[model samples]
Target chain A: MSNTKLVLVYKGFERFWHWTQAFLIIFLAVTGFEIHSSFSLFGFETAVNLHNKAAWALIILIIFAIFWHITSGEWKQYLPTTKNLKAQIEFYLTGIFRNTPHPTKKTVLSKLNPLQRLVYLGLKILVIPVMVMSGLAYMFYRYPQAGIIKSANMEDLEVIAIIHTFGAFVLVAFVIVHLYLITTGHTITSNLNAMITGWEELEEDENEPSVNDEPVFVTEPKI
Target chain B: MQNFKPILTFLFAVIAPLVIITLALREPETDHELLNQLREKYTHQHKLGIDHSKLAILQQDFTNPHAITAACLSCHTERGQEVLKNAHWNWEREAFIPGRGVTYLGKKNLINNFCTGIASNEGTCNRCHTGYGWQDETFDFTNEYNIDCLICHDNTNTYEKQKGAAGYPVMGADSPDFRNIVGHVGRPGRYNCGYCHFHSAGGNNVKHGDLEMALLTADRTIDVHMGVDGLDMSCVECHPAENHQMLGRYYGVSSSNTQRATCEQCHGSVPHTNSKLNEHVVKVDCRTCHIPTYAKVNPTKTYWDWSTATKRQDGKPYELVDSVGNVSYASIKGNFHWQKMAKPEYYWFNGTADHHLISDKIDLNNLPMKINTMFGDYHDKQSKIVPMKVHRGKQPYDTENLTIIQPKLWDKEANQGALWIDLDWEKALEKGMEYLDMPYSGKHGFIETEMYLPISHMVSTSDQALSCVDCHTRNESRLANLTDFYMPGRDQNSTLDTIGKWLILLSLAGVLLHGIVRVFISRKNKIAETHK
Candidate 1:
């Protein structure tokens, strides 16, 4: 226990966003599947209304998160890196089984490992964008009328619907993998506790302080 | 962070419009104040400038229906010519049917599941025809005097055309006084249109399930538009006429989308206060939701098996009435099945239709032939899912010729080979074929057929309209049969669904396996450390 120190790895807004987004994703999945006629829980109409509201909330949160990421210089944390990518993969696949230490060290400056960077980047750039665009398309689909000028009208919803559904599937898969990966932290509940309390128990020797010689462990809350 | 400022701004520039447009373009809640303003501006009831009873020409005692028409032509000279070109008098109108070029299609040549056609049954069927003396092929169509002026125009509602009298007014002691009827001529009422339309195919509530005599005194529940307690609109209100050429054309006869009397004509496209409901207007017709069920009051004919005809009751044609007082079986007609408050079948229709012509060849193996195909699908941009009253029946068809037979149904002469009079299928078929001058095989058999009559009327109030679950449900959706397009809730791609389930399951399994391995390794490491 002396070899490790408690570090404020996740900022306050980061934790807030993480939990809020998690709730939204789960809420969206439940109501979305209901709208897809999976089961009748809240009923079709209520399910639709709730799903639409959750989608809008998620979109607004994403916009705020984007602004936060850029202004706080946190966007660079997700920048793609080939450095130790293969080792990270091997650590998850086999190294974890042998009880070897994690390949990547957790620091306040670099919160995500190389694989996390790629996967999170893919979700932000690809999956979430696709979901949002397709969802918007579904909402603003061109309806036929007499007076209005016809412009780039989407006649059929087949493509948009399929794409949206596929995005939903991908999102669900990501959430499942993400929940499971949380358990692979230093302790079984360490990752979950870190996300909740914005602090993680990190091995002292593994973490290197920033160029400014900032303390490795900080008691003060960030943002 | 400063280096990415422009990129962030650019991203926002792209996203801001999407959000703004979404909020802005939500069809502003149908302006009720504007709608009321427009309704008042457009729907003022028009009154005839001159009272017909005050006219000197109408004061004369009319002898016959033709004589009454002659006197009408004397006053309104060009009115006779206008009536001649009309579909009612002509019995057929030139229409550009898709795949069949410009052809004259109407009740004159249109073949239906019920009563077939009017080719050989001209004498009996012509009672509903707008003109007089269409008893046979020799009857003059050019004679403007033959057009019955009082049937549609008679405000008295006493004008009754006699059965098998070649469209003449009933002449016996029970005859309506034409002199009084001629004096009170006005615009066509619901009763005037209902006289023929409601009672087509030999009885009331037989043809169009949406239309019936109950509409004359309909409350809001029966019909929101025509309900006396509601809008109190007449047939001509929705279906207006210009120079006697009525705007609406029945899809049963007409093919093209032109001349349609749509709710959009008066109500406009976006008629709902809820923008979500309004959004569906593009893909779903107003009638689809408004008309949840048709034939609300009277049980319309749903099934008629002509093969079961010719059955004699005490050697005389007799009707068998069901418990509901509906004629279940008629020796003259066939086994009839009737239903009231019937849920309508839905179809993706773009106003255009393809009718089964009398001359078209039929494939007997492919039974339950569609008599009229409503042409549209999910892909068609103009198409919308419309509610329809699908009348199914088994009618006489030529076994050898593979064509539908127009049976001679009625005649005064017992020897003239009318099926109603003689109860003989062979003679009726032969005479009907002779009348049409079309090739017919002597052999006749019953073939399963269906006629799609779009339910446009009998609109219920918004509260009575179908809820989201009605058509958007996993099981027993009203649009269950229409699988051409994906409707959320109602339709889910089975392949995608299976893949989605597998993806989630596989991810769960992978995580569980990894978790167990990690737990075991941690425990092993703990034991080894303790042993050390």
Candidate 2:
């Protein structure tokens, strides 16, 4: 009667990428906040240099991620889906709080819920791209007439910057919700361990196909 | 042990306030006997009083062609005397129409250094304008020192007149001079600076911002030839009270360290928030940029568009060009004016950082007051910065008001160089092991990264090379952070703000109307359905 079923889904590189990107982004946000003088977690100048370096590192990681996703065809995992759309919405509104049974059972083949697929798709397509573009604009923009910067436009940076910061806030909010949802998966340790060790103990009954079917693909167990 | 004996002095200091209160309550004797002696020295030319008390130390013998023995004169040599000669003695300089009249000492200038006129800008400069005292309606500038000793010497003068002291309409006062003139801070200022600064005083409406020449007035022109002497301001307001051992000069090329609210007084924020640039603003001046002398102009007004900068009055050759091949020349004309012609010059971006940031022809004569010198100084007579900049050397930076600017390259470029690496071992190692190699490249353990050079804290524009990013970076560009925050440099969207406000109001009204209509329609629809 265990809710957990043994499944091998997440790969070693995926775990590595997820944790590294998370740490790097959190580091960047912390240092970036300090640079903005939102609060001085690190000293001002140090924060600025750290933020700049972190930005460069994030760019590099993004490039590597794009390559990894494309080569492994993992990028397709975030494509939007409508299966269990009603269940996903209901779960968010009521089931989540009441601990009702999940409408879409998770398996090695299709690890993400419908809502996650949709949100992750939007983030990859819309938010992250905008954040990188606007951040670049702020780092490199200028006016040539008045000798030195005629004005120091920092706070509500240009229009694009507002979009970039808004994207950042969304990412932060998603991270918060994502962490909470992670705890709801099977046994908390099982879901957490999958991200760390690339394996999850899933319910064996979830092998049954869903009403609106999605083909499940499981890899050979590494161990 | 000997110092401990002053208990009685400490007791007196504690009781001083009570003593002052007692004095205020009682009638005091008049000190007119001292005034008569001062009057005697003035009438007969006794060559005394320059070294008198700080309040009434009249510059009797200190006047030119006359000599005064002074604490300053004793130490300063001939060269020092020459330095001291600068109008440090000139308590004030007011703008006067040259045709009106002249002073009796073979001086044709009729400028009056009236207290309200020059130091404390009472704003109504017309009230203290020359020809006569506009305030009293009786005193004339053709005569001299009608306001008495406190007029120039005492920044704060409180006369006790309940029994015998002078009251307001009797003596004027300004609080502790920012210069701490004679080191008496915490004392009420003896004069009024607002008299010379306010716009009505015939000066710039504000001290900083958009370089509009319209604020320039006849009374506070930077050009001496334009009769700047008539303005309601003077030297000590910007310059320091203490000077070189030679009497009145300081060691630096810029004469004063005075902090002026002129810029921030109007511009909402302190520009000093930026360390590197703010330090430069302190060392240099506002004239380094907006001075018309830097702008190339045309000799004749006929075909000239002043904004295009077609000529320079310094007689120095100037070459300027626009994006296309449009060319113009900056030529020197005969009355020290610049002639204009369509000939292009080289761009400022040709070499490294602006080589022409400061023109070489520039020399610091009058130490820092460069107007019409062979150097490129805009001696603006009708300057927008009237009363303040016009009254130079008066408000030099105070030592007590220390503004420190500390700039570090660490924030923008995360990699620490050898110097910083040694200084911050923890962060360096934490960042990466790569931080260790910077210190000694030639030693057994070698590192290849660039050495960290600690630059002198001078904001001067040097001809050092810069990368493409230097110009491209937002922070480095002249379009400062406020550009995005406050519609660039101008109130560009203020009109838009009005439109936005009105739009909000209309939207609210429309929303209310729409809500009412929807409610009415829903009710009607509900009744019809019910009837059906």
Candidate 3:
């Protein structure tokens, strides 16, 4: 039908990180909804224990993923670009449904589209961090200090709970959109297959560009 | 796979501290030696004032309680007379209740729900009486030696006046049980006072929900002031004795004493460091917050429906234990509802209480009578929110006379009319009224009644006090029944709440509509471009 070849796009660690992170997030959401008394699948106590354990596991995975990204120089993939960001939003809003050509290309150096980078960056910096910090605060709220087990003052607890719940809602919305986006690749199952097998089918024209074709702008020296 | 090395290291780095902290923060073993040392220190500090070796009168072989009192009076002459004037010894006091004028009320006069009254059954009831041998109405009250000093002053734990003994200690083969208690008389301990107070209404820890025999060895978590692990204070610390007259006074029962012990006496007006909490002291009693719940260790009787009492099919009285193993139904006492760790009912109470006297007429419209009513309100400047155990019951009353009837529960001679022996209510009432010289209408009915007992003891530590949400919540609040004034979180204005909710919904809808329009316009533009 078309000249297509399998390209080694996603690395081994990247695929592992993606699947593990997805499983963890899904598990967290299920347990979290149970803890919130939303159609309890597991009882409240069991859900709480599972949620806490999953949270700690996710935190550990996140920490290791951060180290791996920094070491492998793969952190550059998340750096957002302004060019074609408006076009990428337009593509999602109207063009994709109408069979219009995609605004951005996926290569080894640029796995995420411009709008994806912005959204993913926001999740990493704002929503995820907020959830993690608020969750930790809740977990250790009743930790003992100065011969007294100090609990969060009753007045302030409602605010913390609201912030945590709001973050969870944002994450849930992101996950729904992310699942839909997985089907928007070259084929319906192309993105999912790539994430599982570490290989993707790309158009010949969508190959990496030459260094001399575009001026590379370095932002800051690597840590 | 090479990434696993650094990843594992990172995971180890993060988890090590958490594990270590969790392990290190485990509660340490309690230091029993330190507790023993503290106990020894407390005992040494609170030694009695009297030297037993120097007091020759105390060493004498006493045959009767009166002889021992005579010996005690040999040195302390005014003590006997002073004690004689006390309501404990006299068993009657001039109570000047508001609106009722002055009336003599005490154990002698008041018809209590428990055991009814002391009238006509003085022998069995007078076992708790401070004076000796109060067998009948003709018993001498003016005798100075009749005062049982050993009942209040004995610390040997051996001085106990058994019921049916007429205010005398249990006797051995020939002499009073003087084994190991020859010279141990001192200021009263919790055991001495609890012997009577704790054992009121038939059994220990039965009458007052706040007081129990468990208090003798309670920990700080149970009771902060009286706990062995905390202050270990005796009853006298709060109810200080001066010239043989205790400072504490029962609200409705006793009105003779002007000096009543209050929380402010020790903690001062403002006890809390937080000024906002201290401000609440004006309208909230200290015990309301400090004592969140009552009967922490033992279950207390909350409801007693005496109307349920009847003979069993086997021609004997039946008894039924509840699911929790508490005596729920007894033929003698009737049906009881016991509650453990009970949240107290709150009310605005000043220092005064008005009791329903036996002579007072009850309005037929007021169906269930309030046996004792605590007086206060939100507008009263002297009033504060106080915690109380409102003991509810159904007791026999004169339906025609419109007064609560007293039944002779216990009789020394086992009279056929005695309620405890014969289990006949009519006969017991007839005999009890005849003995008191009061007219009975012969017609009787059981009426619901409530007795208000102000909760004072079993004070928990500050951390265990009620959280704000306990009372300031929309539903199931402790003060849900209290309708004095509006509380913020508990009450909501329906109009304002609806308006606020509608505004939020409108804002959400506006954002959604705006997004929908933008998407639609962008889609139309793209379609037009493609068509061109």
Candidate 4:
């Protein structure tokens, strides 16, 4: 293993934001489901209020994240890629089990692997937008001329409602799968530790390119 | 980065208001300013608590309730009690009861479906139940009848706190004013009935009756003319003694307080709005207007009744077909009777017999050469849109299919609203073709132009038809009309009373699938990167 100098990749606020956001998302999902009857943690009313507040907080955080990404150009890092894709797929299917080398390497500029890039890109494009739009729609919903509705035919409310609940379920499914994947990290706790301390130890590969003219297998701590 | 300066300015303009609002909200309460300062400034002795602030709040809540039962029971005793018994009471339960436990009960059934669903399956339903404490996960079924009283009486407060009740303390104790009259009297309109009528997650605040509950009560009430007042003619006087409740209610409603003569006492010969009802295209009354043959049509107890807006037969649309037109009900010996509510049978259509036949408009010569008509279908997927063929009443296109000797003749006796039905106006569309003649066209300016339009061209906003939004503004989208749909909350698969409730459940499922794919692909990449 070639020794390499540790370099900071993640800023302090980024980690704080990521963890706080994770905590809030989990809190929101639990309370939201409780409010929706999937399960209950907080009482319905409290869960409603907490869900609302958390949602608002998340919106605020998203606004801030958007600002941060725009300013720092980090959003560009999530651009979908198909580069060196075959080996990446094989690594997950068989190579990882056989202790084969990683198909794609990570760089400071490119924190996400190709597959991760595509997925993150998709989430940014599809999932989050639906959740935000649906949530906003649910909060501000109303039926004007409420009392007069009986006389008028109610056949008009067909499409809007389906979208709101559908968005909610999507967020719900994401939360469920995201929770299970946390255990898939290196050594189970290794990924967890990286999120916590912003550091990860990797094996050195002679064929790998170096960032600062150092051996590729060095300690990297991005915080 | 494109059009950076203009976009920046536009974005700033939008966000500037938000920042200002946030700053304003963050500022301390300005209304809490010392009365001492105002008093000193004027030095004129003023009635300290003189305010109609509560009425404004009451009105706002009645218009849009943040919480149910709390805004209603303040004034109407009967409606208040009904609200208390309703399921909306459990919108949030307290911790003392099962998450699904009852909070307030008033000698009625208290086993809440909401509670039952939550306790065993979730053990979490108690959270939304009344006074539910999420931490301990407990519920109390004691005060569950709150929705019943609150929605009707709109007393928003406990008995002692409400203003203007007869039991309210005399001047030496409690005073009466707008600020204090949190829940007092209600005028006649939709709010008078909206106590339970307006809706559910069940669909667009569905009102069983044509009356707009929000319009029922008024701060400045319109003069109620009980032509032959029911005995003393005081609606809120005897039954509730304080609030309004007609006699004979099993629960909190004034069930056995018979006051039949009161209907005749003040309303001696005529009924209020009777002249208007008689003049309208159809003859109707409260007893007749709300004659629902079906049970649970407006069941106050349930959170939602799925049967609303659906026909009982094929689970199709409510059949609002008006097959009854003016027909000859008289035989050789027609009785010319002197009366107020002229029986329709005496002059024309007998409800029992002449329903199938059509009537014709007669000229002085007694010949039905060309009977003018105006029945048109404005919107039905089945019916074709009959295009405009007339310009300002003069025929522009062929009048070959014009309603000359038309099958559907206008109801003649009642001028107040027949044109509405014949033309398909909105005010006369509820309660199986019951018609209401509102103060449209400034009391008599409505033009009577004969033109060939679809039966669907029922109501014309030619009055204020400048912009499409003006007529359609009642809702967000252009669904103010019967045929167009602006789906509420965009709630997909809205089975609960809302439209498309399960209308297109699969579309949402597709969106969910997309979301799942997005999350899975992203997670896979995250794991791979971690390994690398």
Candidate 5:
């Protein structure tokens, strides 16, 4: 084995945010399914209370994550591009099976490949937003103090519940696919190790452009 | 194939919602023509078979209700005798109430949270009474001609009864001319029955939450049976009278006869087309699904605090109407809380109800005595979940004797110690007890009481029945209080659920393990190739 220099890929706050968000999501999904009467883990009333708390925690985590992404100029990692998209799809479908090289190279600045960008973009912009909005609508459906916005119609609530459930299934599907993809890295444990220690070994040729050499856009303008 | 997959996914995503919306928006096919033909046939069949013009006895100008009844008895000799035997005419019937043994209880003998009792106030209360001149205890119950036939059989809708007149139709100012008012005496319409039933306890739509004045010309949404656009059914359609004995029984009062009007009589035991919903019939009453709410048009009195009855310094009764225009405060009655479009409280009831009879001593320690308690539970075979309007009130009761006191609410004489006349509790209690010959402890205090009134009318359409999720959900279920039997969607098992979750997690781990093994094998092969 050749000597390799360890590099810090994930920032301290980013790791903290990611782990906290993951914990909250897992807690939410567990409590949420219990609230749906899928199981009797925490009893009904306790499940509902825990689910609501987890939901709020997730929302706060998402807010902090959003601020962090914008401030650190890391939001660009989820920008979708058509270039190498077909190749990336082919790599996942057939090339991965044949043990062929990845069509697109991953970098610190452009960590996500084309397909990853699209999927992550959809999650952030579409699925997550839809889940958040619908969840909030369900939570505050009734306003006792407000005379006008007193309660939602029962039929409308049924529709909201359907949409929320649909979003939940989508998220569950994404998580399942994500767990499978983590093993598709250079080595079986490479991706898992990178995420934990925030250091990853890069190919000699792929290491030409340092992460620091990337174009610096002002994340926060001076007042 | 790869390109085709996304295209198919996109197409399916676009078309699925469209198909769902189209199916949702599709109008349900109905045979309006057939419905119209059936309605026509029903209307023809329902036409009054009696021709009053042919009967020369009906053409006579009758001055009083008894005179009219006597004229009618000449042809229908047995009708008066049958009518005289009814509980409505006698105002007393023998019935066994649970907790209280077999006793003579009726509107006359039973004390209600509203109006207290009819013992001393028989003259005023007898306005709704079927027979005439029940002013005192000596009023003959055996008199056949005393029955006011027009109260139940009037078709002209001109029948009117005034308070303090002892069941006589109003004379002079409020009276309709008997000459023009005489018409074909047919089966009672909504107005005929509603005249006394709907307008009970004082004004129209005041007493019963289910029976409202709006039912006279209500739409299909208000009451499925009585609605003008629907069945347009009169009271006697369901409550058919055999020998002047009505088939229906009041909620609080126990019926003497076993014959009572039930939805199953017409709809059968299993009414719903869906077998699953039909299964619920054994446990749930028809009204629980049909009548989602009661008093749709007008509010009904739910809470009455009689302790608030205060008289003015001028010796006149003071009254206060709430913002909703309900009589909140009245010196004669007291503070009342009314509610509109009220959702009924659910209970398990097996036809019979146990009432706290006037003669029975109340357990004062169990404050807020249940004046009438509905009997049943989820486990009982005879019991079905029924909806009811739980009317709450604080009425005067004998503190020492621990019995509800009957106050003389009204009297014709000016200084007869009526509660409404002088607002004196002691004097009214003494007079009221003297009429019943029951001892009152002389010391009276207002005690909270509850009366359960079963809701049977104002049934909405089938589509308006509570949605499945309303009860099958985790929380806020209508049947949340009913926990004797396990409901599938609302309940879960800890052990089974845990095992199921573990199985799913184990399957996922197994898949991950398989993938890791494959990756490991491929890497080992690559390492061997590199060494070669």
Candidate 6:
């Protein structure tokens, strides 16, 4: 406890984006499964209407998130490396039960571990794009007014629905694992509290460059 | 100019809010109100042009139906010639039945599930015919005086053909006054067309489920177009006549898609505020949703098992009523089933149908024979899902000839091989076969049959239109049987669904296991620290 110091790990816009995105994703899953006829919660018509509206909200949020990540240099945190990747896996497998230290350090510069970076990168580049594209296809499948765009009309909805549903399953799985891993921080509530209030207590070192000292690019930190 | 500008500004300020308040207080016109206004304007424009009572030619007392037609033809010289060419008079149309190659198909030759064919029963069925003296093949077709003009033009509502007098008016003391009826002729009303149409297979509402006697004075809920409370439209409004040819043609009698009276004639193809709903217009007919159920006020015949006929109560023909007071059984007809507010079955129809003609061969293995096959599928771009009353029944067919039997069901004289008189199937079949000049097999057996009757009337208002969940739901969907194409909520890939559920379950298990291990380690560490 004496070796640690409280520091800001999340910015205001970042926190807002993360929480709003989390709410929207949960809301979308509920409505999306209803559209699949899994169960009737909000009813078919209301669920479809809400699902379409929430999709637009998520798309707008994603644009803001991408802009913030690029401008704040937070995009660099997701760049993958083999460095400590094996150790992170090993820590979760057995070392976690034996009370061993974390393989990767959490700082303002690097928020995700090796495994998290890979998973999130796949989501942004693969899963999310597929979901959004297929969702847009569902929305614009028919254009009665556009007489010239008959060729652009999608003749089949089965393919689009399958792709969208597949992506939904993957997203739900990711959310579950992500929530569980939040407790793997320095303390059980440390990560959760940091996301909420934008501050976390990390191990302080005199040799390490702190946020108040200087701006340094630390791709791989030595423990 | 500055003083005048100030005065103008004061006047404008005073009038603006007053105008706004007046408008705000006045209620906006609903869709029904606007439609009623339009109907009122149309009614005012289409009054009867001439008074027939003022004409000197119509004042004479006609002794027979043919003499009345002759006197009417004196002034309307070309009307009788026009009526002669009409389908109403000839009971046949020059239609191109795909495989048959330019056949005259109609009630004259075609066999229906209800009454079979009209070849041997001309005298009884000709009560609906427009011309007089069509009792047999010897009846005149070229005579202009035989065309009965009073049947369609009689607005006095007293004109009615005798039961089996071959299109003649009832004679003797009980007959209608000819002089008074002749002076009151006008264009046909709803009852004029409905007199035969609504009573098609003998009784009221026996054939088409959407059309019944109740629609004559129906409210807006029961019917929007012909509702006395709403538009109060007539049959001729939609089925307008050019010369003697009407615009609308049913698939039962006519096969081609050329002369359809669709909603698009008045209401355009895209008639919805919701863009998604508007897109469905290309794939779904308006009747599929608007006329969700038919025979709403009265029960319609759904089934008629002719095999159950000929059951006599001590040698006397008798009829039985069901618990609901409907005719359940009769010695002449058969067992019957009726339904009220019946939901329609869906079919993909591109407006062309192929009928099972009387002379055509049949396969007994294919039971529940499709008397009329509506040709289309999901792949056909021209096809749309239409609502229809699929009347199921059993009718006699030849066991050896493999053809449907057209029995002599009615006659003006008894002991002349009429089923209604003797209840003898063999004699009726022999007489009917002799009339068609076709050989009878001497063996008759009942086969299950189905008739597709298109539902075009009794359309409800917009509020009663089918909701999205009605067909798009997983359970009890109206279109559940139409499985050729994918519907979003109703259909799903089973393989994908199974994998999806497993993925969710396994992820849950993985998280729960990881949580348990973490809690165990943390509790163990706390105990060791406290002991130290």
The model with the greatest DockQ is 1
Q: Better model by DockQ, 1 or 3?
A: 1
Instruction: Give the docking tier of candidate 2.
Output: incorrect
Cα lDDT tens digits for candidate 3, B269-313? 766655445656766789888899889998888888877765564
Sort order, DockQ high to low: 1, 6, 4, 5, 3, 2
TM-score on B-chain, cand. 5: 0.85
On residues B380-437, what C-alpha lDDT tens digit does candidate 6 reach at each position? Answer: 7778899999989998989999899989988877899999898999999889988989
- Per residue, candidate 2 scores C-alpha lDDT tens digits across A21-140 of 788778876775444334546665466556665676666567767887898888878877898988988875566444466777777556788998898888778877887878776565
Task: Write candidate 2's Cα lDDT for B93-137 as tens digits.
Answer: 222212323212111111111110121111122332211122222
* Cα misplacement distance, residue A38 of candidate 3 (Å): 18
What is the full ranking by TM-score, best candidate first? 6, 1, 5, 3, 2, 4
Q: Look at candidate 5 and give me any clashing residue pairs.
A: none
Model 1 spans with C-alpha error above 4 angstroms: A1-3, A93-99, A143-151, A205-207, A210-223, B1-30, B38-45, B517-532
Clashing pairs in 6: none
Candidate rank order under lDDT: 1, 6, 5, 3, 2, 4
Candidate 5, residues A1-223: lDDT per residue as tens digits?
3344345566555666767777777777777776666666776556655766667667766876898799899998988899999999888766876778888876677778898899989989998899998888766543122133335522224456556666665666567667778887877788877777666665434456764454432122111
Best by lDDT: 1
Please give each candidate's TM-score: 0.90, 0.35, 0.64, 0.34, 0.65, 0.91
Per-residue lDDT value at A17 in model 5 = 70
* DockQ of each model vs. true complex: 0.47, 0.02, 0.04, 0.07, 0.04, 0.30
> In model 6, which runs have C-alpha deviations exceeding 4 angstroms?
A1-3, A143-148, A204-209, A213-223, B1-45
Candidate 5, residues B1-532: lDDT per residue as tens digits? 8546645764465435445654654434543454465457545537766786568777766767678888778888889888877888877677776556777767877778788778889888898888788887888889887788878877788777776888888765567555545566778788888988898777766678889789998898999878898778888888988888888878666643366788877667766655446656756788887888898999999888877775664867888888988888899888888989999888888777766777778887897898877778765556788888888999888888888888887887767989888787789888888788988888888999998888888989878987655666767777787777555346555544555456557647855775776677688889989999
Model 1 C-alpha lDDT per residue in residues B380-464, reported as the tens digit of each score: 8788999998889998988989999998988898978999999988999999899899988788898999998998889998789
Residue B401 Cα positional deviation in candidate 2, in Å, after optimal superposition: 39
Residue runs of model 5 more than 4 Å from their true location after superposition: A1-223, B1-45, B98-101, B172-174, B255-257, B313-315, B491-532
lDDT tens per residue, model 4, A137-207:
55544333224444533333334445645555655555555544454444446556656776555543456
